[model samples]
Target: MTSPLSVIILAAGKGTRMQSAKPKVLQTLAGKSLLAHVLDTCNQLTVDETIIVHGFGGDQVKSEITNQYTQSSFTWVAQTEQLGTGHAVKVTLSDLPKSGKSLILYGDVPLVSCQTLAALKAANTDGMSMLTLTVDNPFGLGRIKRDQNGNIEAIVEQKDASADEQNIREINSGIYCVDNALLHKYLPELSNNNAQQEYYLTDIVKMAVADGITIVAIEPEHTFEIEGVNNRQQLASLERTWQRKVVADLQEAGVQFADPTRVDIRGSLSAGQDVFIDVNVVFEGDCTLGDNVYIEAGCVIKNAQIGNACYIKPYCVIDRADIGAGVDIGPFAHLRPDTVLSDNSKVGNFVEIKKSTIGQGSKVNHLSYIGDATVGTGVNVGAGVITCNYDGVNKSQTIIGDNAFIGSNASLVAPVTIGDTATIAAGSVITKDVDSSALAFGRARQVQKNDFQRPTKK
Candidate 1:
C-alpha cells in the first residue's frame, strides 16, 4: 500500500523588498494571493495533511487562509523567531504524521505544478529527494555539491562555498520530499554553525549522504515553477509569465485572440469554438462565451453567460446577465445584474439595463434606461426612453405588452402597463396604464394666442 503524503508550506517572510505591510505570501499575482496559489495547487494532490508555518503577520495569514478554505483542513504553526528555512519546517514537525512522506514547499513560489510535485514525491524511494535547477548564473544561490564519483554529497550556500564550489551551475531549489521518520530524526540534529549562523534546510542533504542514502534530484518542466517573489518587480514578471501560460493554453484549445498580450482574465473564462476576443478585454468571475461570439475592445464581462453568435461591441460592461443567441449589445452599454436579453434582441449605444427582461425581437436602439421592467416581444423602445421604476424609496415595475411602440424621449411611470399594440407618442410621460391598441399622449396641446407683443433686448 502507498503511504499518505503531507505538505508543509513555508510562508513566514516579511518581504522587506516588497515594501508592503502585508506578509510576503499575501502579495498578489494573477488576482490571487501568492499563498492562495500554492494552497490551490496542494488541493490537487493527495495530501493527507497540510501544515503552514507562519511568522510575520501570522494572525492575518491564518485568518485569510481559514476564511478562504473553510472546507479544507490545515494546521497552522507559528515560528516565534525568524531563524531560517530549516527552523520554519522544524515548527511544523509536531503536526506531521511520522509514517508517511512529507513534501516541503514555499508559498512565494506559487507557480509549481502538481505534476512536478507528484514526480518529486515519487522519486523519494530511499527516504530523501529534492528539486534542483541548472541555470546560467548560480550566484547568490545554494550550489549542489557532488562527490568525486558524481554522487550527491551536500548543498553549499553562496556565503559558505569555496572558490571552486562557487562555480557550480546546478543550484538547489530549496524544495524537498523526505520520509516523515527521517525528518523527525534529522531536523532536531540541525545546527546553526553555518556562515550565516542560522539553520539551513539544505544541511539535511549532507546528513542523508553520511547515512549512505542516495538523494534523487528532480527538475521541474519549467523554470518559472521554482521562481520566488521577493519584490514587486519579480511579482510583476511572474504575473506576465503566468498570463502567457494561460493564453497559450487557451490558444491550444482553439480560442482566437486579436492581441493575446493585451487581454486580462482575472477569473475563470471559458470559450467555445470560433470565439474571437479583441484587445484590452477583461473577463472576471466565471464568464462563458459560446461559439461564434465576437467581443470587441475594452469590454468587461463578469459572471455572465453569452449565447452563441452574440456580438458585444466596444466598451461594454456586462455583469450577471444571461443573453440569448443572436443578441447584439452596445458600443457603449451597461447591462447590470439580473438583465436578460432574448434572441434577436438589440441594445444599442449608451443604453443601461437593470433587472429587466427584453423579449425576443425587441429593440432598445438608443440612449435609454430600462430598469425593473419587462419589455414584450417585437417592442420598439425609441431614443431617450426611460422606465420610471423608482419612487425615491421603493421600486416598482413597468410592463409593456407585445408589439408595443414607445416613442422618443418618453417616460413610462411605473405601476403602469402599456397593452398590446399600444403606441406612446414622442416626448410624452404616461403616468397611467394604456389599453390595448390605444394611443396615449401625456403631453399637453399647444394653445394659440391672437396677438402678442415681443420685448426688445435690454
Candidate 2:
C-alpha cells in the first residue's frame, strides 16, 4: 500500500538578488508564478495535505495563490522571522500529522518532474530520503558525503565544507522526503552555528545519521530539473531552458517550428499532425490547433482554437476566438472575444471581428469591423464595410442571409437584416431589412452643384 503523503513548500526567502519588490516565488515563468508551478506539480500527486511556508511578502504570496489557482488547496503558515529553510519547515510542524510522510520542495525550483518526486517518496520506505544532483560545478551548493561502505553519510554546505568536501561533484538539491514523525523528532535539534548563522535544513542529515536512521540519496535524471531561480538573469536563462524542452517535445511529436527559439508558449498549447508554426509566434492561455494548420510569423493567439487545414497569416492577434476548418485569416486581422468563423470562411487583412459568427464559406475580405453580428454562408463582404454594431448607449446586431452581397464601404446599421441573394450598393448605410433577391441603396442622391468652390483658409 502507498503511504500517506504531505507536502511542505519552502517559499520564505526574500531573494535580495532578484531586486524586485514582490516575493521571489511570485516571479513568473511562462506566465505562471513559480509557486503556482510547484503547486500544480504537487496537486498531481493528490497528497493528503499541502502546506506552504511563506515569510517575506507572505500576504501577497497567499493572495496570488488564492486568486489564480482556485483548484489548489494549501494550508498557509507564515514564518514570522526569516530564519532559514530548516526553521521554515519547523514552523509548519503543528500542521503536519505524526504518521504520514512529508515531502519538502522549493518554490523557486519549479520544474521537478512528478515521476522523480514519486520515486523519491517511494524510496522512503523506512527512513529519510534526500534528492541529490551531480553537477560539473557544485561551487555554491551543498556537498553530499558518503562513507567507505557506500552508505549515506551527511551533507556539507559550501561555507561549512572543507577543501576536500568542496571537490565532491554530487551536491544536495535541497529537496527531501522524510517520515513526518522523524522530521518532528529531528527538526528541533537543528542549530544556527553555521557560517550564515542560520539553521540549515541540511543539518538534519547529520542528526539522522548519528541516530542510526537510514538515509537514502537519490539523484534527479536531469540537471535542469533541479535548477532554481534567484535573480532576473537566472530566471531568463531558465525560461529559455523550459522553452527548449517544450519545443523539443513538440518537434518529437511532428510539429515543425520555423525557429524553435523564437516561439513562446505562456500557457498550454497543443497542435495536431503536420501543424507548422512560423517565427516569433506566441501562444498564450489554452489554445489548440488541428492538423495541417499553418501559423505565420508574428502572430499572437490567446485562448483560441484554430481548426484543421487553416492558414493564419502574419502579425494577427486572435483572442477568445474559434476558427473553423479550411479557413483563412489574415496578415493583420484582430479577432476579439466571442468571434467564430465557420468552415471555409475568410477574414482577411485589416479586419476586426468581435462577438460575431461568420458562417460557412463566407468571406469578409478587408478593412471591415464586424461586431455583434451573424453572417450566413456564401456571403461576400467587401472592403471598408462596417456592421455599426455599437452606439454610445447600447449595442445591436446585423444579420445577413446566405448568398448576400454587401458592397464596398457599406455600413449595415444595427438591427438590420439582409435576406438571401440580396444586393447592397457601395457606400450605402442600410438601416432596414431587405428581402430576398432585392437591391437596397441607402446613400444620398447624386446631385452635383455647378458653382461649388473651396473655402479660403482663415
Candidate 3:
C-alpha cells in the first residue's frame, strides 16, 4: 500500500527584484496568480493535506486564496521571518502528518506538470527523490554532483562551487519528495554555514548519503517546467511559453488562427468546430463561440456567449453580452454589459449597445447609441439614431414595437414608445408615444428665407 501524500509550498520571498508591493507568488500569469497556477497542478495529485508557508504580504495572500478558493482544503502556515527554503519547510513541519510522504514545491514555479510530480511521488515510495534539470545556462542555480560510479553525491551552490564544479550543467530544481518521518528527523540537522548564511535544504542530501539512504534524482523532459520567476522579464517569458502551449492545444482541436502568435487567451475560451480567429484578437473572462463563428482582427471579447455562424467584424469590443445565431456585428462596435442581440440581428459600424435587447431580424446600422431600450423584431434603426434614456439623475427605457422604422438623425427620448409599423421622420426628436401605423414628425418645418436673410457681414 502507498502512503498518503501531503504538500508544502514555499512562498515567503519578498521578491524585491519584482519591484512591486505584492508577494512574488501573487504575480499573475494567464489570468490567475502564480501561486494559483501551482495550486492547480497540486490539485491533480489528490494530496491529503496541503500547506502554504507565507511571509511577506502574507495577509494579502491569505485573503486572495480565501476569496478565490473558498472550498479549498489548504492550511496556512506563517513563516514570520525571511528565511531560506529549508527554514520555510521547517516551520510547516508541525502541520504535516507523520505517516505519509511530503512533496515540497515552490509557488513561483508554476509550470511543473502533475505527471512529473506523480513520478516523484512514486520514486519516493522507498526513499527521498529530487527533481533535477540540465540546462546550458546554470548561472545562479545549484549544481548537482555525482561520484565516479555515477551515484548521487551532493548539491553545490553556485557561489560556493569550484572552477571545475561550475562547469556542470545539471542543476537542482528545488523540488523534492520525502518520507514525512525522515523529513522531520533530518530538518533539525541543517546548518547555516553556507555563503548566504542561511539554512540550506541541500545539506539534507549529505545526511541521506551518510545514513546509507539512496537519493533518487529525477529529470523532467522539459527544463522550462522547472523554471522560476524572480522578476518581470522572467514572468513575461513564462507567460508567453504558457500561451504557446494553449495555442497549440487549440490548433489541435481544429480552431483556426490566422496568426497564432498574435492571439492571446487571458481566460477560459471554448470554441466549437470550424471557428476562425484573426490576428491580434484577445479573449478574456469566459467566452464560448459556437460552430462556424468568425472573429476578425483586433477584437477584444470578454464574458460573451456567441451562437453559431455569427460574424464579428474587426475592432469590436464585447463584454458580458449574449449574441444569438447568424448575427452580424461591426468593424467598430461596442457591446457593453447586459446587452443581448437575438437571432439574425445586424449591428453595424460605430454602434454602441448598452443594457439593451435587440429582437430577431432587427438592424441598428451605422453610428447609433442604443441604451436602456427594448427593440422589437424586423425594426430598422437608421444612422445617427440615439436612445435618450438618461436625464442626469435617472435612466429610462425606450421601447420600439415590431416593424418600426426610425429615420436618420432621430433622437427617441425615453419613457416613450413607438407602436408597431410606425415611422419617425428624419431629423425628428420624438418625446411622446406614436400610435400604430402613424408617421410622426417632430422637427421644425422647412421655410424659405430669401426675403429675410440680409443680415450677413456686420
Candidate 4:
C-alpha cells in the first residue's frame, strides 16, 4: 500500500519587505490570501494531516484559515522565533506520524500545482525527493551541486558557495518530500555553522548523501508555479501571471474575450460556448453565463446566473440575481439580491430592482426603482416610476397583474395591487388596490389661479 501523506507548510517569516501589518502568508493574490492558495492546493492531495507553522500574526492566520476551511482538519504549530527553514520544519516534527512521508511546502509560494507535488511524492520511493528549477540567473539562491559522475550531491547556499558552485544554474525550489523517519533522523543532526549561522534545510542533502540515500529531483510545468511573493511588486507580477493562465484556460474552452488582459475574474466563472465578454468586465464569486450571452464593457457580476442570448449593456452591476432567456439589461442598471427576470424581460437604463420578480415580456424602461414587488407579464412600467415599499418601520409588497400599465412619474405605495388590464395615470400616487380593467387616478385636480396675484419678491 502507498504510504500516507502529511503536509507541513512553513509560514513563519515576518515579511518586513512587504511593509504590511498582516503576516507574509496572509498577503493576497488574485483575491485570495497566499496561504489560502497553498491550503487549496493541499486540498487537492490526499493528505492525512496538515500542519502549519506560523510565527508573526499567527492568531490572525489561524482564525482566517479555520473560518475559511471549516471542514478540513489542521494542526497549528507556533514557531516563536524567526529561525531558518530547517528550524521551521523541526517545530512540526512532533505532530507528524512516524510511518508516512512528509511533504514540506511554503506558504508564500502559492501556485505550485498539485500534479507536480504528486510527482515529487511518487519519486520518494526509498529516500527523499525535491523540486528543482533551472534559471539563467541563479544569484542569491541555493545552487544544486552534483559530483563529477553526475551523482546527486549537496545544495550550497549563495553565501556559503565557492565561485564554481555559485555559477551553477540549477536552484533548489525549497519544496521537498522526505520520509518521515529520515526527517526525524537528519533534522536533529543539522548544524548552524554556515555563513548565515542558521539551521539550513538544504544541509539535509549532504546528510542523505553520506548515508547513501538517493535523492530524486523534479521540476514544475511552469516557472510561475514556484514563484514566491516578498513585496507588493512581486505580488502584482504574480497576480498578472495567474490571470493570464486563467484566461488561457478559458480561451481553450471556446470563450471569447475582446481583450483578455483587461478582464479580471476574482472567482470561478463558467461560460458556455459562443459567449462573448468585453473589456473591463469583472466577475466575482461564482458567476455563470449561458450560450451566446453578450456582456458589454465595465460590468461587475457577482453570484449571478444569466440565461442564453442575454444582452447586458455597459456598466451594469448584477448581484445574486437570476436572468432568464433573451433578457436585456441596462447600461447603468443595478439588480440586487433575490431579483429575477423572466424570459424576454427588458430593464432599461438607470433602473434598480431589488428582491423583485419581473414576469415574461415585461418592460421596466428608464429611471425606475422596483423593490419587493411582483410585476406580471406584458406589463409596461413607464419612466420615473417607483414602488414605495419601505415606510420607515416596515416593508410592503406591490403586485402588478398582467397587461397593467403604470404611467410616467407614478408611485405605487406599499401593500398596493394593480389588477389585470389596470391603468395608473401619470404623476399619481396610488395607495389602495385598483380593480381589474379599471383606471385609477390619485392626483389632486388642477384649479385655475388667474384671480390670485403672484407674490412680490421681498
User: Best candidate, TM-score-wise?
Assistant: 2
Candidate 1 regions exceeding 4 Å error are 415-420, 430-457
Candidate 4 per-residue lDDT, tens place, 1-458, comes to 87999999999888999999999999888778999989988899999999999999999999999999999989999999876999999988888788799999999999999999999999987679999999999999999998987767999999999999999999999999999998899888888998998999998989999999889999999999889999899999999999999999899989999999999988788988999999999998889999999999999999999999999999999999999999999989999999999999999999999999999999999999999999999999999999999999999999999999999999999899999999999999999999999999999999887789888999
* Candidate 3 C-alpha lDDT tens digits along 1-458: 66889999998888999999999999998888999988989988878998999999999999998799887878899999866888889998888888789989999998899999999888874569999988899898899999898767899999999999999999999999988888898888788998999888888888888888888889986677899999999999998998898888888988999998899998889899999999999988899999999999999999999999999999999999999999999989999999999999999999999999999999999999999999999999999999999999999999999999999999999989999999999899999999988999899979887768666786
lDDT of each residue in 1-458, candidate 1, tens digit only:
88989999999899999999999999988777999999998999988999999989999999998999999989899999999999999888889898999999998999999999999999999999999999999999999998888878999999999999999999999999999998998999999998899989999999999999999999999999999999999999999998888888888988999999998887678888889999999887789898899999999999999999999999999999999999999989999999999999999999999999999999999999999999999999999999999999999999999999999999999989999999999999999999999999999898987787788899
Return the TM-score for each candidate structure.
Answer: 0.90, 0.96, 0.88, 0.94
| Candidate 1 lDDT trough over 10 residues, lowest sum | 263-272
Q: For model 2, what is the error of residue 451's alpha carbon versus the real structure, in angstroms, after optimal superposition?
A: 5.8
Q: Could you arrange the candidates by TM-score from highest to lowest? A: 2, 4, 1, 3
Question: Compared with the true structure, what per-residue lDDT tens digits does model 2 show for residues 1-458?
Answer: 76789999999988899999999999999978998888888877869999999989999999988988787678999999978889999999999998889999999999898988998998886679988988889999999998998777889989989999999999899999999998889898889998999989888888888988888888888777789999999999999998998899899988999999999998888889999999999988999999999999999999999999999999999999999999999989999999999999999999999999999999999999999999999999999999998788899999999999999999998989999999999999999999999999999899999888989999
- The local lDDT score (0 to 100) that residue 78 gets in candidate 1 is 93
Instruction: Give Cα distance to truth, residue 226, candidate 2, Å.
Output: 1.0
Assess the local accuracy of residue 373 in candidate 3 as a C-alpha lDDT between 0 and 100: 97
Better of 1 and 3 by lDDT: 1
- Better structure of 1 and 3 per TM-score: 1
Model 2 clash pairs are none
C-alpha-based local distance difference test score of model 1 = 0.94
Model 2 error, position 125 (Å): 1.4
Candidate 3 residue 226 C-alpha distance from true site, Å: 1.2
C-alpha RMSD (angstroms) for model 1: 2.6
Model 4 weakest lDDT span, ten residues long: 144-153
Residue 160 alpha-carbon offset, candidate 2, angstroms:
0.3
